[model samples]
Target: MSDTTSPARLVVLISGNGTNLQALLDACQDVSLAAQVVAVVSNRRDAYGLVRAQQAGVPTAYHPLKPYTDSGRTREDYDEDLAAIVSGFQPDLIVCAGWMQVLTPVFISRFADRLINLHPALPGLFPGTHAIERAFTAFQQGEIESSGAMVHFVVPAVDAGPVLDQIVVPILPHDQLDDFEERMHVHERILLVRAVQKWLTERASLPAV
Candidate 1:
């Protein structure tokens, strides 16, 4: 276990361009943020996040998502490799910034409460890929009240863990998926920074940040 009173050390996992990774880097520049990103991990070698992480002086690595999925490899095989890579850093928090793989039980059990993620929709709403499109469709059908982002503990079930924090964005009449997603993402960046800072600056009461 990490020394709760000490600073938080994070390992960010990403699959895509890692805009959020940039946000985290920005937050760390603040003296009071109380956390450090020691490593940025990606499932794709060519992910832009890798470049950003490297430029930001964070160690980086790639593990293709396919090798860990339902591609004939045993869960333990994938979990062993995953565990070695992640555990090597001794991360206090594993931020699934945009990590695209669904972690296996072995990985989840080891990390369990230590892992956190940001999802694109308010919980109990859009829960998968193309969340913006899903929310737009639902809003068009007059069903969705709102949509936004949330930070939650990573569990076996995707985006179905206890929420650490969240910000709700209304489904506006003029909202396009692209525009809405962009705006909501801005909120996501600020909100996540706040959450991490709160956890770090305050006493060692881990309250889901």
Candidate 2:
């Protein structure tokens, strides 16, 4: 837990555009959130999230897995190095916002309860990537009436950790995939911010060790 007098530091990881990361950065502008993003890390050098971080004047790092694989190192090695980089920021919370990599225990156990992720579907629904598209397909087939997004703890299982917050998005009678996806993104941004706030609140309430 962070000192109550200081805003909790966050290190966000992303792989793509990082709209969710943008949301977090935007929300942190409100002092009441009691959190600030200290750094943003991405596995892809081309990721726009790094640009977002730079625009916000937050430090950024690009840690790609290829360098490890190219040198006969394993994914665990990459994860270890990534963890080391994140540790330098001394983050109170680590957020995987659309970070495409499935973390190994090397990283997961290092952060333990301090890590969370945003998924495009509800808890126990779409567990892996492309969740929005999968959920939309399910809805189109009449197998489901709605899809949702959630922020949850990150464990070894992909997107199966306990949920912190979620919001269901109904599939309307005449919804296209693109439109539905756009709406889902909007809801996701809000849910992610709320989840971070909730986590910060809960952490603050915990008795200091």
Return the lDDT, model 2, position 31.
Answer: 68
lDDT at residue 152 of model 2 (Cα atoms): 89
> Between which residue pairs do clashes occur in model 1?
none
lDDT of 2: 0.92
* Stretches > 4 Å off in candidate 1: 67-71, 201-203, 206-209
The alpha-carbon lDDT assigned to residue 138 of candidate 2 equals: 94
Candidate 1 residue-wise lDDT at 142: 93
Cα lDDT tens digits for candidate 1, 118-146: 88888777786777788878888998867
Model 2 residue 22 distance off true place after TM-score fit, in angstroms? 0.6
Q: Tens digits of per-residue lDDT for model 2 on 1-209?
A: 46866899999999999999999999998764788999999999999999999999999999999989899999999999999999999999999999999999999999999999999998899799889899989998989999999898999999999889999988898999999999999999989999999998888788877
